[model samples]
Target: MSGHKRFWKAVSVAQENGLFEPRLDGRPIRLPQGKVLAVRSSALAEAIAGEWGQIAEGASFTPDSLPLTRMAGTMIERIAPDPQTTRDMLLGFGVDDGLCYCADGINPVAEQVFAWLSGYGIHPSVTDGLMPVVQPEGYLEAVGQLLATQGDLDLAVLGVLAQATGSLLLSLAVVGGAVSLVDAVLWANNDEKSQLATWGQDDELVRTMENREKDILDAGMFLTLGRQVSI
Candidate 1:
């Protein structure tokens, strides 16, 4: 809900059916689809509640202020409903992953990321040009199997990371803790950075880059909080 006034007097967390629910004024918060928002992780619920709590009374707010809540809703309403579809969507990001089409020599980050995927038996073809390289069926199947193992929340975070960086390799690396968020952003934007260096800064490009950074950081935090054991 964008441009809505903060109507709740207080924000809190409630335990329900062994799940954690963020409450507003003693009532559980509902997703956009009208379902109560319940999460398996207490830490995630608390953090989501904190987002609501931070809004000043009578102040205007937007959904952008509730990144974790949106992600949680996506987990419940989207990923949980049809996991196979979600897995396919995520796996498609790997098909034309930016890391695999570097124009320059092999990227160190790509090398590390490919090695990591290799452990899962997913070996994508890398090329030094813009032409599309068809990844083998075995490679795609392996990646799909790997994605199938991730929980809904993990897939939600991976979706955000993949969209933000346009690189499934970087997304996996970030989720695996093999790459820092800062470095991931840098690696994702290397081409843009090089262009900016030559052609000078564009305000729109800078803003786009900033937004990407925010998205990556938010997803990273969401995954970290969601993984915490409920207590």
Candidate 2:
């Protein structure tokens, strides 16, 4: 099965068996499923490295051996590690590239994220027309909490969504997989196109997009009229 389908299946099974009831809400939230996908994805990536490096890790394992349960162990290890690299890896490019999307999309939430980063001297700017709306008494602490949760969610969603929908990042992975001369050049150009493509469609992409919206909501970032201010 495709990674996204497999991930949802695993989550559905685990939920049915009550394995995820403890850490998740009773309403069947996607967080547990997301976590499972994250660990499985990382383990798969590591296994790929082992394959290329000739290390023989999990040489006999089947496709069912999704090792996503271990991702929680690496959470603390990644926190505050390398912001630039993490942003690039998650967004399929650098912070600047993400900002470009924010501007193009006129995504208020992403603008707020950039604004928050800029407050810490990151100074992420918008080239097209994207700009953060200003607000007063902004809950920086609440924003931090939301960002922490989002950090975890993005790791899971990015890989699965990209794989499901042939996103730019997945194109990069495909290029890495080609492992040949002429294929690399063609793959590079394809990756460029994928990166610059519009993103209004793709159901899987909406999962991550919805998660971002929820993060903003959970962070109490909305103003009195239930609208996001340009804070």
Candidate 3:
């Protein structure tokens, strides 16, 4: 029975010290670069195994197919191995933090956006775009402080989302207790929404929103399961 399965039929957790790892057929799984896929968070490790378990249901072995597992491997192989690059890349998202943009006309999300900014004392400037006049040092510093307390795997997850989305605000809000990533992305996309309102919603716009929504959802889900990342 198990012999017919395309992937490992036996999925398990390896508990040691105070961490957990996924074991396939009683052997620990390794990344493509041969690094063991251990994690400080039991929940995260099990979630990674679940991604692998799906291969048993079907027969594809692409990294994209196993995004979460790929996330673990990425954390171990790429992000973890280079902390300076990772930090630089993560912090680099602030150069165009989503909150900096504003709609020339009526941006529905402006109130919500400014409300979040009020607490941070950022005011808008009107020159090139209706943007936050202030630079993002304060916001980036706050995110850096929170990131300073996380594990590599969690940092990798947030990094993937942050870099992909190009907004440290979303990463920091989702990682910390500031706001939900969904609301954050929605606010970020307010300019897009304004464009759609003026130009009308089309297939291309819909697909763009779909992809962004997926990224935001993925980041939020990872953070939800990753409470121990902060611990």
Candidate 4:
């Protein structure tokens, strides 16, 4: 089966089990829901790797032409490149200015990441609870919300969404937390029906989810920032 179809199948399963009604940021997302999203996304990531590879292929600009942070800086600047041949090279992954690109909502790193992913055809927006929530512009707040509710099943749904949208990086953020949350739930699912059982098992689940909280924080600090910070 095609990648897109497979992705949709995943979503269908998730939804059938009451998992999701995909949402891109705030608006409802109905196209290419699951595995298809993952395949296209992988294709996009490979494409980005290819484009960067080509750029660094034969050219080696000196410190003047290429500063210490050359790659990171140039990549950041190219968030909105001049239209031309390279446009196709990126395959439409990028931002087109947010609600107010220059206003309080404008964040260069977040915008660049958003644009880059969108360029590859992944649409990202705010998601809260069971709805595709839309945040103002900051990436941290939205991500925090998803992570905050890790045990609520939203994280898994969001993971499926991230997989579909081809945001593996972001998926990492959600999945890392969601997996533990799901595991905790499964553990609780095994407990008895009595109050004592609920207290013991439910508390264990909360503790498990809480312990992994740092994973989400780490993701926020590193993944949300991107490759520059690592350097």
Local accuracy by lDDT, each model: 0.87, 0.32, 0.65, 0.31
Candidate 2 has which clashing residue pairs, if any? 39-68, 40-68, 133-230, 133-231, 134-230, 134-231, 135-231
Rate residue 25 of model 4 by lDDT: 29
lDDT of 4 at 138: 48
Window of ten residues with lowest summed lDDT in model 2:
220-229
Pick by TM-score: which candidate is best?
Answer: 1
State the lDDT of candidate 3 residue by residue for 1-231, as single tens digits.
123334566888898666678888888887778888787778877887787677755464666556666666777888877766777677767656664554354244444544554555544332346444456446556545555666665676677677556666556555655566667677655656878999996788777877777767766665556565536
What is the C-alpha local distance difference test score of candidate 2? 0.32
TM-score of each: 0.95, 0.26, 0.74, 0.18
The TM-score between candidate 3 and the true structure equals 0.74
Error of 2 at 124 (Å): 1.4
Model 3 is weakest, by summed lDDT over 10 consecutive residues, at: 122-131
Residue pairs in steric clash, candidate 1? Answer: none
Query: What TM-score does structure 1 among the candidates reach?
Result: 0.95
What lDDT tens digits, residue by residue, belong to model 1 across residues 123-196? 88878877897888787778778887888888999999999999877798788877888788888778778889
Could you say which candidate leads in lDDT?
1
Candidate 4 Cα outliers beyond 4 Å, as residue runs: 1-201, 229-231
- TM-score winner, 2 or 4: 2
Better of 1 and 3 by lDDT: 1
lDDT of model number 3: 0.65
Report, for all candidates in order, the number of backbone clashes. 0, 7, 0, 15
lDDT of 2 by residue, 62-93 (tens): 32233232222233234234433444454433
